[model samples]
Target chain A: MNTTQTEWNLARRQIVGNAASIGFAVAMYGVSFGALGTTAGLSIPQTMALSLLMFTGASQFTLVSTLASGGTALTAVIASWLMGTRNAAYSMRMTPILKTSGPGRLVAVQLTIDESTAMGLAQDEEAFEGRASRLAFWATGLSVYLLWNLATFIGAVSVSAIGDPKSFGLDAAIAAGLFALVWPQIKSRTDLSVAFGGALIALALTPVVPPGVPVLAAAIVAIIVGWVTGRKLS
Target chain B: MMWFAVLAGAAGCYALKYVGSIIPAHILEQPIVKRIVLLLPISLLSALVAVQTFATSQSLTLDARVPALAAATVALRFKTPFILVVLIAAVTAAALRYFGLAA
Candidate 1:
């Protein structure tokens, strides 16, 4: 095949591959979030609005969990923002792929999220910094968004009558997706150490702090570990 | 209204993203920013792990039933399938509750 044709074909496969490998868990986790939000006392519209508007599953879940526990709107908003700070990093990583333009800029921002960010980076070495990767990245984001919101609505509607989420294995959905996301990134002993340290810090902080904050604290610990060890490696 | 908060929150989020995208390519391409951004996923994932593993229904617990530490260890050693590891750990917890190991 010609060079341009080859690039197009490869991009096509990457987009499809990302969807197959990562899409299901990303979408299903929305169901878990929806159910949990409803059980936490958010109404159907409230839950749907969170999924449709906020759309970051982690942030949405954190917001509702905090609200359920009596956290104010301001508190919930800050927590969600903190939870989503990683998207900025993802955006940075994708900057090269989706070249800065008026329309491209808006689309890129709309598509920024955990799965697309990771999937965009997962493209082959050369593709990582090219337009093809951006195409794949946007595809992943749009597909996940559509699928997630739809599944979330289904989950919210069903949660009221479903009784216990634990009974249906719905609670495991988020854990499963997180595991998938984290697994591919563990490339070295240092990464493993940082992971362990963060997980430990999170465990230790859980009792003293709220649910979402522990994760934030763990992230800080990992960043410190990265900064400290990063110099030696460089 | 709550809907307004949701819209504002959504708008704020997209605005932050647009701000990130608007930085000139040359500026964002700087070596320092690139290096730091590379570690962003680790930061986000760290937050996620801490919350899920440590925080329980209302309180944090180091109890055996949660066993996230152990499962993560298994995930490391076997390079086990992520979904499989999550299933094993989650099943352990639900089974514990089912069998009266913990509440």
Candidate 2:
């Protein structure tokens, strides 16, 4: 191991706080998702179903927001499925590292989310040896999974008493939640271009297109941005 | 309708992950394919935010969501953290509506 005694201590500290911290943060996100689900007119069971099955924060948010705006179920599903495509990208890096297979592959796939992937990859970058990376992945993933679901249940039931979700400003809160999710990802000018370009397209098309179709149509912005700006990364 | 979206959407997303697991890495790692996959969510999520904040039905309207998002931007600019940004936006919108200023 290339790690020093001090480095081991530091890594130990990180291991202690890292997954728990990430899990707490994601629990907050899950609470918002739960509230958003209910405010968007989903029943409690439906809300829980999305949390348990859909699992991905961005995809779940897309479905709730699309439906809230009167998009058909098909559009809602497509938009969420589109959002979840990023998970596929992450899984590209994750597949070989995790080396999961058979029935265990199913379990691994559930944890193949943004936080777990990021944590796992960070450890892999730190130590080329796979042990630390795998540990980080499971610890972070399981903590996030347990806390996120529990918080969602709490948020859903708590908000059930509110009258007129708009009066509570949940609509704006939902948008803000989406914004927060993307803000951290916008670490570069090109990333900003893609995000802003996509927002412009969606806003422009919102009036002309059907409620959900604009979201789907906005997919072209990323395609064009990647072609012009990001194509060199073979 | 509810179960259809929940179950089918989950299935679709899970399928994407499962596909990546089984697919040849060389194919999935193709530059253009990789680039687009990385960029796709950024665009779609930003687009969704726009639609949620501005659009109501077939028309774009100015409302509390606008100011609320603006509040969130300020909070983000200050590094106020994610939960606070969300809370700020909600509270801003709620305050405005409570005062009968914006719906």
Candidate 3:
């Protein structure tokens, strides 16, 4: 019993440490979102609603950026939806591991995001009975949700004091945050090639296409690269 | 119209999550689907970075974001903390703009 208690304590500490770091990092980016969202003409309440309901960073940013560029509502929604689709893939990957049901399943789905999924899957291999993984998921999800919303409120309220957010380069912070998120994922030659190719396509199309269209068009590059590479491997 | 878009977006996002929950594990685990899933974020995020950094009001223009993003790339290469990466990028761009070096 004593050893079991010790193990539980160790697992709790480990999970909390990981969750805290990721949650804080994510919350900082939420500030950038809040400032930019309001500058993009979203009311403070609207910005908060996006953070609360959509609760996905990249999708929320895509929605606001689309709107900022005078894209039609339909176009903004479509762009946001495309980005949100990734959460579906995340949910598919997580549901089996979580094995939730009924109301629990619904709640779990709401908390599903890239950070939580990554934290859950990153548990120490030697931890027993899945305790660490479960704790990591719940802790990271809850903390990030709480901190991100709080940061958003703070940022929105303080936007006036900060003057033009762009003057402070807060607008560029979004891309920087995104770049940091994607940095650790590019581990292979294929990943590097695909990323560069997609970025180039988007850049080339930006001047010619509508605001949100280039992003959608770049997905074609990803599909072709994945298909061609997969065929070659087979 | 904005409210309508937000509500529709919320509903669509919810549907995506719910649909993922209902799909069979074997189907989602297929090799082709898995490969696409893995590659999707890399491509999509890179595209997003490009659009957000370089595009403005339906047009592409060079600006302080270029140098700021370059600084961010260096910070990321050194494995700086994520928050620091953003701060470095922001400060770099802000300084450039303040000095009349970039719009």
Interface RMSD of 3: 2.0
- In terms of docking quality, model 3 is medium
Candidate 2 segments whose C-alpha is farther than 4 A from its true place: A1-16, A125-129
Question: Tens-digit lDDT track for model 1 on A1-234?
Answer: 788788678768868777655666676677666776786677889888887777776667666655544445665566566556556656766776767677767777777887888777776737534655666677788888888888888878888887675544334434444544566777878677776776677667666765455555655655566566655555
Real contacts retained, model 3: 0.63
Give interface RMSD for all predictions: 4.3, 1.3, 2.0
Number of the candidate with higher TM-score, 1 or 3: 3
Please give, for residues A3-98, the per-residue lDDT of candidate 2 as tens digits.
Answer: 575676677568658988999989999989889989888898999988887788889999988988878899999999988987887777887888
Global lDDT scores for all candidate models: 0.63, 0.86, 0.81
Clashing pairs in model 3, backbone N/Cα/C closer than 3 A: none
Which scores better on lDDT, 1 or 3? Answer: 3
True contacts kept of each: 0.27, 0.80, 0.63
Candidate 1 is scored at a TM of 0.71
The superposed Cα distance between candidate 1 and the true structure at residue A65, in angstroms, equals 5.3
